[model samples]
Target: MKLLFKSTLVLFTTALLSQAFAKTTICYKKDWNSPATIEVEKLEGGECKGELSYRDMLKNGWFLKDIKIEKGKDGLNYIYTLTDKRVVEIDNATILKNEYKKLDYRPFAIKILNVTDETATINVGNLRVGQSGIVQHYYEDNKTLIVSNAYVTSSNETASTLKFFPFTDLKQNAIPTSNRKPVTGDVIIMNYMYDSSLIIAPSQDAFSATREKYKDNNFLHSDLFAAKLKSEGIPTPPKEVIQEYAISQNLGTIFFIIDNTIYVVDSKTFAILDKDIISYNYIENKRMPFYTRVEKIEKNIFTSMLDYKSWFGFLNKIFGDDTRSEDERLLENEIAAGELTVKGEVYNNYYETMLGIKK
Candidate 1:
């Protein structure tokens, strides 16, 4: 009888320890910015106690602030504060024993689309199921994302388009003539020169064609002026005021007086195209003769002329000059002239006319 009683006591102790060793639920606070403390204890048979610091507790996402473990009449009572500012207490033991692993994967694909001289559009698609956020990709070598500012459209298709503004450094290399040898007839070469300064390469075909077209298009001439006024949105000034502004900007002086309005056409295109009234006002002081600034006036006059081949060739010439000093005055002058000519012509002619100004 004594042996049986001893055997029964041992068996009971073993069973209790086994139950106490079962998995305990780990609890943790999700807040990473703040720290919290944690405590662990055995509930059933043996008395096992442990305390976890906030930093260590973070690894398991469980933070216990004020913790206590005690054996009561009911069972093992584990009590703790979460430092979450809330007073809620968790009682599950299974949460402590579970192990977690992180999962990560590349969730999208990148597709390059048409790259124009000014812009590039790329398509990004196949986002992870149900995941939504700005898609980002890092260029490892550059240590930067190839592009950001990606916007997602709600077309139910998982695709997004990203427009990339090419870095300034890449612009030169991307030019069509970057790898080509210098050729006289090459449009790129012509563009290079034309872009530098208003060096008019008088190609017979281009010059005649441009001249003839403008002469026949009377509406186009008036449209140009009207467009400028519309774009400026300021009330039309008197003829004197208009002339002064144009001359100050080196655009050219007013020539023919049409119905109280002075008509000033870009010099290069003047003979070819009808005059565009740059300003309309009563004549004031005629200190500067209209022909005094004829060169500038002529340059301004034809600045709006569009010869794609010539323009491209001009750009190539400017960029191809490796021996030119960085601070060369001539180059600077050329660039300034080119900029003024191109912008003035395009703005005054095509764009303004498009906005509707009747000749």
Candidate 2:
């Protein structure tokens, strides 16, 4: 009799708790492009009388997309639809009307659909041929850490593919073994430039296409840097431990080539500064070693951060003698010396992020 009473008491408590934590079945989509899925969301405390709010969804990085009511045997079923975000697609007419200029240079949030040994396919619909970014994974605590660098070699209207590379030291001849690889559902911050002096490609074949043009360039090659790291002792460091070390040697500007296009991205703001498409043709109606015509069409995107003078200096350094005016050199020195007043908030934010100085 005593054993029976004890068992009954335990069962009663468990039932009461279950009733108190009862949830409403809700409909949700992981992203806008995803299919609707069903989930049971916990109701608030206090006799289980509280209702779900939009604030609760926002707290979990979700937004209310729609709500529906359907008649059921239990009386009425309430289906609440939610999505990660509301994405408004850019129409072709708007793009043709120069309305793309109104869009801000915000980091694109993309989800990994599939993964492989060296690459991952993403759900991002519009990625330029040479665009790059960083892949990250969120922990249970909601904090996200960088996993690898991602580069786009090809993209279309619905899906895009990315190649992954490990984070490496800019000045060292060593590549630390990456402890993590991108898996499905990992988030990618697309077009987020990690450093200014870095030039990245998805593979050796992609890099070889533009190798002849940049033979005299002083840019850091991601593949060569990774090779150097392999030659050194393979040291696998934690993600947080490698954050500062990965960025300490950055000089500030990113250049990447995909096929015939070269893209320039500003490391400070992670914004694309320019795109140049190289066209080749035979001169004098005949193919000759000395008569091959290589022409370039430059898209001059003038911004306050990257003025024509800065662009000229960048070109000169890569193609010319790397000479800088005294004023420019002094400004750079001031920036390196932590004089925030010299370059304003843009440079200050850049330095803060570059040095991993959290606010």
Candidate 3:
């Protein structure tokens, strides 16, 4: 009995020590510059599964390159690894700070249409010619809407006003109805005015000049705009040409021009989330049932049309008639589909059916 008690006590103490000495492996990588070194420290009260703190790296101008946590083979340890080493630490905060000084003389404002318990409806105000507006901030803390001042302008209208009303009076009281939906955090809005009378031509120099002025603001002046132009199949401009034209303006909205039609981008990541293209065939004075068309031009890839209709009345109301073609009846049956195939592998039907791709 005495020997058995001693053995039990030793086992209990061993288990306690093992629990207290848990550790984990943390992996990290440096930026494009090879041989990048980083000093890491164990934070007090941190995870028993080894966790590395980069507080020192952040202070030394080193940002997070990439970090991912995974379960270890034994299931007791958590492995953290940095995947990408190309991400460089940029001084975005410094750039934004410097851009504030060169802000044009424009009083930034938003017309509060309504304020509710969970949301606020507001319209962006326009700036006068030669004046600019800035998006200082958009935040909600303790149920209060806070906006900042930022400005941009061109020689267009001398003045404009934004309307505001009580929240209870606006339509769709359940949901906020501003010009655009605000993300949960803050939705900063900036307005700019351009003189329509000015016959301005597109030029690289003009855009460059504007970019220089707002260098600190990180405004997507020309480089970003140029990419947008190409993605939409718009004609690309010369490399370094300047044009005398009114600066295009946005009312705190994403702007895109497709086939001479302008569009607004509203999401934080302004990438085309989803797109469907439809083609119509003019039949013998009468429309026929929409059929799915599939085409495989390369590899295990295929493209197809999934649906069509004579009139997309619902879409016309929101996107407006601009999306409509010249035909008297809107073609609602055209859609483009993409599919991929792998050699010696079964094709994944999941991708096609999930996005309504007929092929």
- TM-score of model 3 vs. true structure: 0.20
The better-scoring model by lDDT among 1 and 2 is 2
TM-score of each: 0.14, 0.30, 0.20
TM-score, candidate 2, is: 0.30
Model 1, span 90-129: residue lDDT tens: 1112221322222122223443334332122333343211
RMSD, every candidate, angstroms: 32.2, 22.7, 21.5
lDDT of 1 at 281: 31
What is the lDDT of every predicted structure here? 0.27, 0.42, 0.26
Model 3 lDDT at residue 155? 21
- Model 3, 1-359: lDDT tens digits are 33543453354345334433232222332121211222343322212122444444343333332232222232211112211221211222222222122223122345433333223333432332112222223435544432322222212233333221121111121221222222323433433331111111122232233334333333433433433333432221211111111123232222222212122221221211122122222222211110112221121112112111211333354346775434423232121121211211111121112112313
